[model samples]
Target: MRSTSLTTGYDIAILGGGVAGCVLAARLSEDPGRTVCLLEAGKDYGPHQQAWPQKVLNARALPRDDVWERHAAVHRIRARILGGSSCINGCWNTWGSASDHAEWSRAGGPMWTAPAMERFRRAAVEQMGLRAVPDGEFSLWSRAALAAARELGYQEVDMASPDGGPGYGTPLLNSVDGLRWNAAFAYLDAEVRSRPNLSIISGASVDRAAVRAGRVRGVDIVVDGQRETVHADTYVVACGTFGSPAVLMRSGIGPASQLRETGIRTEIDLPGVGAQLVDQPGIFVPLTPTADLNTSLAAKQASGDLYVSRMLIRAASALCPDGSWDLHINPTAGPPLFGRLPPGEYEAGISALLMKPASRGRVRLRSADHADALDIDPAFLSDPAGHDVAAIRSGLEIVQELAASAALKSLAGPAADGHPAQDLSDQELRDRVGTYWHPVGTCAMGTPDDPLAVVDGEARVRGVSNLRVVDASILPTAPAANTQLPVLAIAEMLADSLRG
Candidate 1:
């Protein structure tokens, strides 16, 4: 990490040095004359892989360390490290469907079209060194799952391409030889970090932006237990889906009623700042693996080739739009995500995730304090129409079929007395639901005529000049795939806009 005093002003100040922030910093600082500063609330492990924690660098499992809250609810497990959630995620990279881009274009502009965004997507893929899963990485369970999907009549398609239809395939990975290659390593490499005009500050918490007359003059941040203000010609908020809205509300940029309740004076009454929070919710059906399956998985683990999941089936439910998938059926067999099993025993299951849900949640500030936890309600399957629930049921039906397939049943059988997920009541499904960790649409982008639009098509704040938000929060809807690749591509595209 390059050390620099925060006392000096800069041309651009990017808050929250996560995935998007890193991209913006690297791209915006290309010109020697432009001064860029990236501030992160978490620790920056520097520009070396050896300096990072082993758990964070290991791609085999999700790292609980360096997260915001320890032992918190599963839904709130977001990384507080410099690379953001990429440092702690599954290291999977996949793109959304054409329908997703159409929605984005409607909300943002033509720049969001699939053709327009292709170059940026390709750029992100190259920069991150994303690659297809190697043949050697496929475990016995993965191979069987692929065969099962094939037997089910699903064609194989390129999961990384947006043009593909419903199919079963492996996602591009950001891991190399079991090492997690995070955004920090990709975007903030040694060459980028050596730039004299760029500054990377870690362990600095942003309190609020000092806005006056719809213009941000400076940002008030807390570093080393001291409050200080950093002035910049332009300020960009990339704090992510949850944290970005919290910062805006603290800066008095959200719903008037909610801000007043938190004792914050309103600067811009943007009701959409924290509304429309959407995420992919799913239910995992546990299976009892046969002794033969356990032996094979254990052997793979011993060879350092055990990956919980390597492929997924993109399936469309009855309610899904024509020619698009609404569910992701993932078959996993490996060490349990939570607790450990007896030696040689592994956790095996098939998870059906509702990729395109109509349910909307919200993020609200409990108080004006930056350290205080924000109130977040995912409201999974809470759509009054029950469309989301019905979609999950349809996905569960597919799960049952996949599990009963001869290719899979021979290796892992149904759990004893395990209730069929499709038969579970609404309440029961909600009780057992888990998130896919892909959250978006809090600070949605849209035309100025839309009241809920927090940012405009160019990512500029609706009522604030020289301030913008370029992150997942600006996405008006959740894509039909994991958010990592989409976020990287969006950031890459927005970096060009910021430069222009």
Candidate 2:
């Protein structure tokens, strides 16, 4: 649905109505003089609360997140609806630490420093109603895990600074009034949406940017199976890690060999268009609860007032690094979406996440068509140092230690798959791992001299004018935690830069 006037050209055209897209469109339109168009391939719920899907608004673990593309276990569970994956993701509000931002600054510039971005962080907390999960809501299983975490020397279980050292605690989340408060609600409220200069078009799939002489002139989009061109003075590709790269590759702007093979004419020979993909790979240990406990959690979940709150365990300095956590140990009791085990096989799980993975992946065009899913090879656990698997193993050992302790005695079941921890092979490590739902760096922004860079420090596309990439795709590296908050903050900072 188009909301702006029938103008032939706009000041800005934003591709992908995800977290960053919604934010950029809103912030840019605030000028009132700029004509902005936000195009989304997915359905938009609009400004009315009743228009939103109950499943999308409710902060529950829908089965939509578990749908995976089976190529080496690529959990391709991104939200196709408005607000992007934040519409479908677990609502944990994890911001990576100061050191994480410091690393980002080295790639981009001093503008990406934590202090420069802190205002956006505060804005997110205020607008999303982010608050701590109360102690009263802790399940019987979580209470035991809390005691176990303390017993295992994780004294500070409360959520610490995103840049600080490890701690185990119930975290702040984005759920308010039992519904998911996604980016659309935060940035595209009725007041913003009603602006005359702003237009939002849903179900508008972008094919490619129409570039001429290294400058974006317009975008070719597919609306209701018909081709149309939307002219814009400037364009922002915020389609995300997998998408922004695919769009560029299809527009004849990627590696020359890949473009030639696809039967597309070459525009710019960008080797990093779909390279340097990074994500946090993880594994889970499943455990069966006593029949009585299982029955109880099932009943509470049916009530739906509140469900699926959890605490996290981050591994300490000895295991990963001195400044930041290397492992994320999270436990779930009621949520089936957290199930990595086979269907109906277990009632509880302990997920061991390998944060700061050294292994890199690549996303390539399956075909020139925007509809074809990209060929994604995360190459997880391929790190030469083997540090990724080692840190995860350390986290699993902690899970075992917790289970065997008196606090959780008889509450936690036996080890999953019957494989002794030390006996598991490298193949087993690769086979058992999955995603933490955070993927990044497919269009990483860095110093222009860097060969792998796609966009620059200010988010402007390298070698291209009137174009920028403002999304998780431009994340130089994956932040230490979930990508939702960080992605939004990055958009806010870039929006300011664009305005200037």
Question: Candidate 2: lDDT over CA atoms?
Answer: 0.78
Q: How many backbone clashes does candidate 1 have?
A: 0
| Candidate 1 residue runs with Cα over 4 Å from true position | 1-3
lDDT per model vs. reference: 0.93, 0.78
Query: For residues 1-500, could you state the per-residue lDDT of candidate 1 as single tens digits?
Result: 44456768899999998899988999999989999999999999999999999999999999998988999889888879899988999999888899999999998999999999999999999999999999988999999999999999999988899987899999999999999999999999999999999999898999999889989999999989999888899999999999999999999999999999999999999999999899999999999999999999999999998999999999999999899998999999999998899999999999999999999999999999999998999999999999999999999999999999989999998887777778889999999999999999999999868889999878999889999999999999899999999999999999999898
lDDT of 2 by residue, 346-465 (tens): 367677787678888999987788877779888788889887777777777877776676766557676456665535788897888888878898898888688998888898887788
Candidate 2 to truth, TM: 0.93
Q: Cα deviation of 316 in candidate 1 (Å)?
A: 0.3
- Model 2 spans > 4 angstroms off: 1-7, 63-74, 157-160, 317-319, 338-346, 415-417
For each candidate, what TM-score against the reference? 0.99, 0.93
